[model samples]
Target: IKPPSTESVAVLQQVPIKPLTKPLTYPSLVSVVEFISFGRRKQLYAKCPTIRKLEERLPYHLERVEIETIGPGYIILKFDNFSVGPIGAYRNEISMWCPGKRVTRSTNLSLYEATEKFALYNLSRPGTTIKTLETKYTPKCILNCIPLTIENYVVDGNDRDKWIIRTTRPVKTLQTDFIIRHDTIKYAKEVTVTRPSHLPIRIHTDILSEWNCESITIERELTHVEVVDYCRKVSKRTDRPIRSVFKSGLGGYSTELFQMLSRELNAKKMELEGFFGNLIQCATIYINESTELSVLMMEPEIWIEVSTTPPSTVLQPIKPLTKPLTYPSLVSVVEFISFGRRKQLYAKCPTIRKLEERLPYHLERVEIRTRGSDYIILKFDNFSIGNFGSNNESNGKIAMWCSGKRVERSTGQSLHEATEKFALYNLSRPVTTIKALKTNRVLANETLIFLDTPKCILNCIPLTIENLIVTDFIIHTDILSEWNCGCITIEEELSYMEVVDYCRRVSKRDRPNRSVLKSGLSGYSTVLFKILSRELNARKIRMTVFGGNVLEFANIPINETTELDVLMIKPGVLKIKVCARRTAIDRAF
Candidate 1:
């Protein structure tokens, strides 16, 4: 755009080809990201203007993060389907790999102190949740980087130092693999440990049997002699009720633990409602007015859990999927990416795009819809992606959601383009066999017209579908003729006579179980009905526009060609239902 002058018409200086980029604003980027890959995370962390107050705004949950230093000077951040590094080998280089792409580039702060600084930034977020944080070595930076208290902590593998996890919030459940020095279990409300490891760590009986938590699970191989010994110690320790389980030592029945408790503590066997173990075979050991210990045995695994309350109340730590815990191959990884980033990867990353294209997508039902003309959403199976925002604004923010949390990012593509681009790259790649397909103007519980619905959906709507429900969607003639769906319900396309021709054409080979047209048969009803009657040859019914029929609702069989139903829903609305075997008489209540 250029300023115009009356004297001499000012010529346009330049026409920008693309939308302007969004400025790097820290406040706008405050989203809780579910997945951040090795390379991308570092870049985002490095964007932090200062190192302090890192937890004040960024409230992310790095569900599964693995920090590895496999080779000398080689560090890696593995999350989702990608890897960030082996970065530290070169002072200025960063390497990343996914299914279709692997890139190695020279940069300013990737391999050296810059990487360390980014790692520091990650550990500084207080109250943030790291569902499963696994590290080969607990570096000084991670231990010292805790500016504020974290909600939960998980300790895995061998550790040189027993760093106490100081959390201000309650630790729901803590599962430790031989954490000897740090009183980590004390802070947890419930604890599940493997009875410690073999040597010196196993020797600390107090640490091993610390019942500070409300409930505890101590699993190990148990013998008859060891069981008797443990019972005596439990009698001496606390009489609240100690429930222990070992394989199937009794050969059968859940009464083994109940029988033992009754004999040792002189505990009474009472039929308590909703007690643990198997109540049919398991009897509750009622010692006091309120306390009792219940046991359940499930095959090779043991059923020993000591608790003041029933063991089922204890919250178990949510373990990250074992497949995702390790560095995953592209096919194995669940595209754990953000909305904006996923679109970028599909478009720019040839490797990933090709792999996705080669694979077959299992689609049960697909729904592509538009909200007025501004927003659009494509839903398939349980997964859905939504796009919204104006593409023309200079620095407009585009918000979208793919799988995890909703992400809002600035984009050059408008909502229509973004929705279509995502659908094209994602849907077009796979051999989509849809069980059912719907193109609608309205979605979610609201009604809307598909004024801007894309062609990609209609072109590939599979034949396996039971119904092809199109409401207020602009339809193409070729697609209309090609459909052999069991039920064909359309509105927007029914206005054109060409669509009626298409209907007549498709009805020749395979008459849809039923069909409904909202409009276009008004003036040409005689000709169109005559055409349909001749094409289908099911039974003839005269369709006289919306309201000329004698009966309000008629199963009119005109000329003995087509069976049709004229429904006068309201003053301005009319409907024509074409049913094959059943007429209005047979369908009437």
Candidate 2:
């Protein structure tokens, strides 16, 4: 009876409980999406299509996202910052590429299923914006499913021809790790291809040859044969009037091409020697007076460069009293353009770089000066043109000033990273003459980009130097053996064996243009006379404790000359004069 009364009492009052929160508004729904666990979001999508659409419609901002279909179809969310990925199939896939505080819980979905579900839930709608989308060996099905606005698209080894960069606007930067699609390149303002060290980004040379981009850089070293073939394409690239094509070589000297260029085009033939690192030269092969291919051999690699003279000269002015200053007639004037202006033109865009390459410019001085450990300044013509150092205002960017005006910048990149761009541009600038290039140490970026500062200078140097004077720099035996200059004075120390080796190498050189090894080294005081007399079987060498220009007439005492070929040996430094083997000293006295 008591229980029945208690049950009847409950019926007198009916209590209603309301929802703790109301129906989420659109903004509220987005806010919920933001804080909701990725696992719960996936579960919500798994339940109904409507919730999936809602998830997609609400904006989910990501700095970067990487989708890799090649390995179990992995979709790494918040890849740049709050990483939550390698989602598991058994709700316990805790393994993450990023081991940090911000971790996403794993779920009961395989990588393939999780990737698809994430794409459907997070990427299918209109409000998703991935600042940078990285796809690695992703299949076409997944690529098609990923319908989001990507600002920058990075493709890495899409082995299945899934090379795509679908963006709302032209991709800011298309970074292709190895495989680069010809069609995909036109969709980007700048295209950079970084291939694995062992593999070159296999691409159609013709397609890349005519690419007109803000900047297009492909890190591929072609074989000598491929270089010639590429040059052939650039030669026939008449549609765009390609001024030149610069390609790095695999460090092979194509002597046949050199000979052909020299003979057919009436060009100077150069004999390559690996005295220093590789035989170095700036030899040109003229297809005609208008079109020429420059083959430069710097240690470690050969560079294939083509400079096609445009339809008209770049110096003559149109319709003037002395010479008319019409805009059309200023083509030849590009040859006389200042180094600063030429550099600016090169940095502008691809088309301007092409135009700037057609005419050779002379740079009085290009100095790579390091101010402390942090800054690397490239000074030109005795002016503080640019520095690759970071300062407060720069915000870790590179600021370049041309003629007292800030022309351009390297935004959001380290000093080492920015140096590569400048090195690439500097290597292509048609600088026929660099009076002096000074650098204390070899400059390489942190990434160790292929063309370091030292390599760049070596490639830019012309075959012949006017008056070469190297001071405070370490000069080696190779330099003494190979330098082709009018008057050479090297403030370098060399042992007696080095001086003797210089003559031996000189004697071994088969090239017709031979330089006489005449030098005065302080290293070989009285010792050189004894060694030379022993090595050369000298009839009579004056007993001078300090010799002067030791073995000036080579080790052999050739009586062909009146004065004895002297070996001037000092004590600390070596002063070497190398010229065409002329009337060398004879030990007639």
Pick by TM-score: which candidate is best? 2
Model 1 residue 150 lDDT score: 39
Worst ten in a row by lDDT for model 2? 580-589
RMSD of each: 34.3, 26.1
lDDT of 1 by residue, 475-531 (tens): 555565554443344433254256345545544434443554433334444454455
TM-score for each of the candidates: 0.35, 0.40
Top candidate on lDDT is 2
Model 1 earns a TM-score of: 0.35
